[model samples]
Target chain A: MYELTKVIKDYHRGREVVHALAGVDLDITDGEWLAIQGPTGHGKSTLLQMLGGLDRPTSGSVVLEGKDLAGLRESEITAIRANAIGFIFQTFNLIPTLSAQENVEAALVPLGVSTADRRAMAASALEGVGLGDRLRHLPSQLSGGQQQRVAIARALVKEPMVLLADEPTGNLDEETRDDLMALLEDLWRELRLTMVIVTHDSAVARRAQRIAVMRAGKLAIKQDTRPAPAA
Target chain B: MFATYLRRELRRRSRQVVLIALGLALGVGLVITVTAASTGVKNAQAAVLHSLYGVGTDITVTQAPAAGTGGPGGFGFGLNRGTRTRPAPGTKFTSDRLNPGQLAPLADSAVTKIARLNGVAAATGSLTLTDVSISGTIPSFGGSAGASGGSASGGTPGSGGRGFITPNVFGVAGVNLTQGAIGPLSSGKITAGRTFTSADASANVAVVDANYAAQHKLKVGSTVAIGGSTGKSTSFTVIGLVSTASGSGSDVYIPLLRAQQLSGLTGKVNTIYVAAASATEIGGVSKQISTVLPKATVTTASSLAGQVTGSLASAASLANSLGRWLAIAVLVAAFALAVLLTISAVSRRVREFGTLKALGWRSRRVVGQVMGESLLVGLIGGIVGIGLGLVGASLVNAFTQPLTAAVGPTTGSATPGGSRVFGGAGQFGGSPGAGPGSAFRRLASSQTVTVHLTADVTATVIIAAVLLAILGGLIAGGFGSWRAARLRPAAALAKIA
Candidate 1:
């Protein structure tokens, strides 16, 4: 679950300041497939980073589970990130030095898992992504789609409270993107995972339960186009 | 954890680690070798001094000339002529020096009571001159430790050839016997038919050194022709010969009245020998004796020893000071090189470390892993340095003689014959024969020596050298990783270029 109350962020150098995020108010619920769509430099990544506690906000509060992120110490925030959060980057950021299985296992290092158990869990996560045989392959050795698949396995392995993927298939081909969308949907249905994926693709947006458009660092109204027959 | 960080750091920068170790090793090794060689030199000098001056021969009492100025010490003007193995009150540092006669009581009434005091050893008398010789019934009392030309490396006659000898003679006052019986009729105590008894105080008899006897080829029962300061000549029978070295023996032993007759002085003795019972009592007794003879200075053996030791200590201190600073400077340079190289290597792995950090690894643990490897590098460096030092010390000593030569605050000229008191080889490098180049070459060659390095001394060397090497390596790793941890993931990603 993610919640923010009037979040603002900025960066400064010498005598100049750049307001990356002017004011943003947004909220998302559990198991909600929400898409925050925006053009480049509209505070999309900044918002994601603030929500993930990777960056601090200059003003206002970003809350999760009724606790303000600003109030947590860096170490406490690190613990939260270790146990509750998982991220997917645009480039499929797997450690180059580690094998595919170890890339997944890297996430478990903070969880205080034993090495043997972590390796086992990583293997299981890879199998879930349907690349169990490619455990020993490096990120450089894997195709873009397969690399993203390994990224997804690493994210899912932690069984986190939320999956925050910035650009999961941004680098994939159209066909690969389509396949990734299907895989994501199957995983969402099977695991009932609460995932917030930011994307500019209409096809990807159509699969989400709700799509919230962002304009100039502020959230616009959410559009829920799922079939109304259930109501 | 710190060790682990060090270890990782060392593993990561193996080349830098090895280089730093080497720099430190060379620095420490040089210091050790030089220090040992210098120490050896000081010991040898002290040995030679012991033989010349005897066990406690710190001060010598010579009478002021009947007229004419010598120096402020009433001994002589030449720095090479006085008895200053120890520094006088005015000296900057201690060394083998003979203080001037300014500190002494020239009058005889001043010292008579001191001889009777407790702890007083036999107070013998002696005479020294800038130029003088003896030829009486001189015993062949040649001392082997003197300028025997034996300690020389080549074992051949030096270019200087056979040394010339002067034949001027003088009579002397006799001291009562204490230590040993004479073994021959030499200038030293006679171990023969007889010493002139008080009954025969005026008897025309004489003794001589064995070497002196050999020089003039005189045997016991033979007669010798002697000369005086005033061209006085007298022939006396060689009644006995003493077994002392060449310098320690005397040419003639007659009653004080007879000496007055031969030297053309009514009843004047030129020198006095002041001996105390034990070494400890010498200091106090010497001071008390000086009070009576306000014109003559009195000194103990220890003061002379201190003067010699202090001069060497000064040299050592100077050398060590420069060495310590040099070691630190070199170590600093090594550290900087290591740190820069390590940072360069670790910078390439920034993202990897960030990933590790994001995985909840503590910064300290990472630092430890990096630093652990540095200590291993330091150990290797220390071993190399110690080995080098040993090799240097041994090689230097083996080719050359021990560096321990007579070092002193005193500039007084020493007689070669007096060096026999050390009972070992006399002082090396003291004669005019060995020049600086020869000394230097000797040091470069085999300077092998028997140095008893006690545990404490060894400990001091190791602690000083090894600690320096280890500290140098660890600083290199610590500087690199701390910078990587502060990067924000987004900024870090952006700054990866």
Candidate 2:
């Protein structure tokens, strides 16, 4: 579903240029659950942003379905993200003013979805995550586990081709984290989406079919735990 | 989508929106109020000018006097002597004017010629009797009814003896016969009897000012002997009585052709009041008239109003010019303040904007949202400001009196009791008994001069103000939108601050 060819990303901080991603090459099969795991500053988040089209690579290219993302215009990249990719932030990143349902519907806004259709899709997505009863509750009113469930519903509402999660369970308790991981796995299987989760936890990485470990702006290791399916 | 985003944003940050709106409103209000007040003053000045030069006469043409003409030994040195000996043009006299011949400009033929010119609605000639002297029984100051010619010109009267009061006479051709052309005769000033008309032009008729008639114990149909510049006395029947207010020049009105004949300067006129076909054509007509009479100095309503030589002129200038600029300064400050408020409000939402970007919202969409909210704020502020401005203008108008000045046809020096043809009340702020403060506050408490406000909030002005407000808001939001567009979604999501 996605491929990165020698992807390099540099950040300008005052008088210094920090390379967040350097010469990264990776590939993911269709409908596979992949996890990129690394320490705090090892470019895990940067690679996920480039793959989701939230940020562009400084050099090289990221390709989805044979189309190079680096060669497209900014608007074209945003269109691809709106239609094919969804992101779940570590902080849950729900607009504090919006209710849970509204937060879910927000993902469909850039896709030019009708209000009624968006509402219907958002309701179904929330029901799938067992948050249908908490549709009108704001993020501040929701529990940590429930807020993470809302974020998952928001990511699922769009029915994107790829679901990207950046440290999804970072702010949750151990029990809530485990529940959210199991919910994510269920969504991955039911929606048949290519899921890419960037995290520092080995336990979260172990649930994925394949794990790529990044260290010092480089892909250090790749481990496959699932058997290959028949063609 | 933009509307929904805007609605939520405004609802969430309504306090900031109100703050910015109020700032803009204050600026727009001040400008509107001041501008309206200034317009009111200009309207009042136009009214005064209309009364001063006769209604409908937008321009006046006067011939400049010959160089080296008026001095101690020149023309009009001490013409108050009421002498019978006509002063020569170049006479080395102490105080005598160049008799009628030197002062007259347009001929009877010129009046007809200029009237035929394009853009000229009407043209009329006037002959002013500047040095005419009349020897009549001047009722002492209090209407005691004294004998005629009891005291000669410049002579001191004996105890209890009444002195002579020389009344100047004005002869006009095309004046509004019923109302008359000048003060004490123009509408509302006539107390009794009726004014003369064009039909009485050839009749030996006269309209005696109420003030002059009261002093002389004269009435309608009474005959008065008017001494001419050629030292001849002619008897004229007082056809009507006219009561004049202070500063109204002259006390008698007669026919222009008779005045010309009386001054022995037949076929000549000293002043010409020209009316253009329309207000917009005044300029072109003035220029055309000037070309026709190159030696004449032409004055227009706008040009006369623009002069700030006296207290009244200064007040008008304040209302017309200084006040407008002051309002603009306030408006600019208000816009700047609004911009700052909007920038602060928008900047605080940087994280939310980043979230939107991550959700695939384009940069233009973000810009549109910011701009939409700003325009809404500006619109609300503009409406509030307009209301405040109108109220302010009304309050100012209520407290301030319409400024007035003494203006006349020629813009020339006024002569006491002389035929001040086309002279309105208080010319040059030196009306016979005017005080020093007369220039600024010339109207009496009993009199009311309506100052109509010109700041009526025209559609064009409203549109322009709204456009300016929108532009200001866009400029302020531009900074925030740029910052939002440059935001890195990954960094923004991780920001805990």
lDDT, candidate 1, A3-112, per-residue tens: 88888888786789777778777777777787778887777777777877777899989898787886788877777777777777777777665679988987887777
- lDDT per residue as tens, model 1, B1-497: 22333454455556766676777677667656656655554454444344334444434444332222221111111223334332232222111111111111133332344456566655444222211231112112243313222233323221121322112322233322331121112123445545555555566676554556677787788886543334334576876665442233244554444444544433333344556666666667767666655555354445544444433344445445764476556656766776776677567666566545544455554555445555566667778877876776777556652233232323222221221111011112123223111111111121111222211125566676677667655666567656655555556443221
Candidate 2 local lDDT, B1-497, one digit each (tens): 46766777788888988877777777777777776666665665655555445556667665634542321111122333323433333333221111232233457676677778889887776654433333333232432222122222212222233333333333222232432443223432567777777798677777776777887789998986654544455787888776544334345667666666665667777666677888988999888887888877677767755442334566667766787787777777877877777677766777777777778878788777888888888888788777777778668766665444543222233221111322221111112122111121112211222333344545655566566666656666676566666766666665621
lDDT of each: 0.55, 0.66
* Candidate 2 runs further than 4 Å off: B64-105, B116-121, B129-200, B203-255, B258-265, B277-294, B308-312, B320-322, B406-464, B486-497
Candidate 1 Cα deviation (angstroms), residue B324: 4.2
**Docking quality category of candidate 1 according to DockQ thresholds:** acceptable
Worst 10 residues of 1 chain A by lDDT: A222-231
DockQ of each: 0.25, 0.52
Model 2 chain A scores worst on lDDT over the 10 consecutive residues at A220-229
**Residue A102 C-alpha lDDT in model 2:** 88
iRMS per model, in Å, is 4.4, 2.6
What is the alpha-carbon lDDT of model 2 when measured against the actual structure? 0.66
